[model samples]
Target chain A: MGVSVALVITMLELVGLFTFATSGALLAIQKGFDAVGILVLAILTALGGGILRDLIIGDTPPAAFTDVMYLVVPVVAAAVTFFAHPLLQRWTFTVLIFDAAGLGLFCVTGTLKALRFDLGPLQAVLLGVMTAVGGGVLRDITARETPALVQADSSLYAIPAALGSAGVVGAYHAGLPLGIVGTAAAVFVFGLRVVAMVRHWRAPRAWTRRRPEVGR
Target chain B: MGVSVALVITMLELVGLFTFATSGALLAIQKGFDAVGILVLAILTALGGGILRDLIIGDTPPAAFTDVMYLVVPVVAAAVTFFAHPLLQRWTFTVLIFDAAGLGLFCVTGTLKALRFDLGPLQAVLLGVMTAVGGGVLRDITARETPALVQADSSLYAIPAALGSAGVVGAYHAGLPLGIVGTAAAVFVFGLRVVAMVRHWRAPRAWTRRRPEVGR
Candidate 1:
């Protein structure tokens, strides 16, 4: 709530937004989408989660649409990716690192926002994870690709976000200073996500079970 | 609004929800998803559009979550699909008819809700179309299918919703009685959608354009 703390949160949010936008734009370029599609995907990827969060919490118009800076950042990020994607292709891992950072930061902030809205702890955690991963899900769906969220082959995504959000909720309930605790939680999620990617970690599929072709 | 009008709207909404839920559940069963997956898809498809509409307009918690009847309708629809899907499979065209009816009803209701929230006419129309088609989009994405909204091969879907929404918006601004105009619009949308489906109408894709492998 303090000015300095708010400023730090804002800075982190911008970084998260930028990373998400870049990821979306790069994907659009790779998919052979047009310029308009690239811009739309980038903006949606950056702002979709927050917009979803605000809407669920009864926040009207959503902060992303209201704030000029929030809108501008994604456009700039898209432009950067649109022109320089070939050059940026070599740094795929670097983009993934930034995307992980965004996922981490979003989970913490989203959880805090839900708590502020007086949602129950469990609901807050759910919303936090949604806020972290929802945008990428939207991007993939729009591009007609299978979302990594539900793909067994994809590296761990939602688990890190859930852990980050759970940690934030715990710290908040424990009366810890959010400025420090929140940052720590984000770093933890970021590290976990990066490690999962490096190690090619995956979520487990359901165990094989017998079932009749018809009802039980 | 009068009590009778409210009752009619609620009835129509339930019908819409049931149809959407049936569609989702059928898709899940076809995809060989488990019982839980069927229920999840059914509920999400039934409620997703209204939830999106409510969130966008800052109506928190969403009516779908708050109203027990709304929740109950979808569950019943899913149950019907799960237990009697073989019987229901014979009525695939019948289900599509019901889905078109739902689409028609939702566009009118969604536009009216947006207008109530003081959105501009254009914005209201956009929301209306979103409300009508949003649930189906979510169902398709969750099932990892291409959304018909963007698929050129698919029959006209969002188009009917747009037309219905636009009519509602125009009638409202012209001070026409919504009860009458809204119903008329819904009927028009339903007719158009069924015709499109039967005739195999499709949206046009972009024309061929020369481009480098990289950016223009």
Candidate 2:
């Protein structure tokens, strides 16, 4: 049962990888990165977090090396964006959904990997959060823009991933069915993100004081 | 004695950080990254490896947070490069030396950290190698270039760091004087790199058959 669920999750993760790669490539182009930059961003967005996670876990010959599909997916995604850029721009929502799916899958995969490494729950959740957003963070930085995570106040990006990771871990510990639990966790994260986008729900920000008035 | 040696190495690492950050920032400007991109590259080159090292060791908050100097050095380096790029370009050799220093320091520091976590010698050495070169790999990919490590015809970059790390660990186990051992390791790695650069020494490539002969 766990094996089947893991396989399903991996498949979803691949789709997510492709989507995320395309989004990264498009963003690089939008930011005026050259063709080389676009390809680089695409691959980085798809592979960076996994590489970091694997390295931390002492997993040699990282996932990108062992899996031909992982390598192929991002390249094909980048090529599609390169050729169909006009259509992609016209259909921005298509990319956004893919990005969302990718985000959900990565968060789950990252959380699971951390748990497999026997990390504490909080650490597992944090790793999940990092995995979900790390690629986008790398993409923005490479393109030389303020990271969307820091700049986009309206997105509850990290929160949803954190919650999903926690839910999966919690359910597993509580003896919940893996398939039901994993699917529910993914759906919860995906739903929350979509809702946050549509409703413009945002994390609360602290107001900054300007030139504090003489020890008021 | 060990503490003093570590402090000296850390100080050199900071200097190296400043130099590498400046190089990254200069490259960003050359690529026409706005202020944001330049700063991102600068920070990545400065903190990327250390951050990876800390994370692998499960060090919460990472070194970047513990050492305010780490943060300050990269920002200052970026600012200097932003303003004095023309002068920096002429001092490329100086920059390379600084980068080499950072690489050597990280190689040692990463190895020590891995040992502290009780990893085997091979694992510790591998971690050191990863920590030394990981940032540059990330930076190159982000900048849309091939990682120097994977370049087919490049001289030995990571190999020297690996050898240096092994030397340090071996010295520690062999009851050698700590200060002399570390200094020797650093100087050996740095001198080897300098020689390689001057001599254009490269790793031997495997020979491949240009054409297939008919089966006997």
Model 2 DockQ class = incorrect
Off by over 4 Å in 2: A1-133, A137-216, B89-95, B211-216
After superposing candidate 1, which stretches have Cα over 4 Å from the reference? Answer: A89-95, A207-216, B1-43, B56-58, B63-134, B146-216
Candidate with the greatest TM-score versus the true structure:
1
Q: Give the TM-score (vs. native) of candidate 2.
A: 0.55
Q: Which candidate should be chosen as best, given DockQ against the real structure?
A: 1
Please report, as a residue range, the 10-residue window in candidate 1 chain B with the lowest summed lDDT. B207-216
Clashing pairs in 2: A144-B37
**All models, RMSD in angstroms:** 7.6, 11.8
Report the C-alpha lDDT of model 1 over B84-108, residue by residue, as the tens digit: 7766544557657767887998898
Each candidate's DockQ: 0.13, 0.04
TM-score for the B chain of model 2: 0.87
Model 1 clash count equals 0
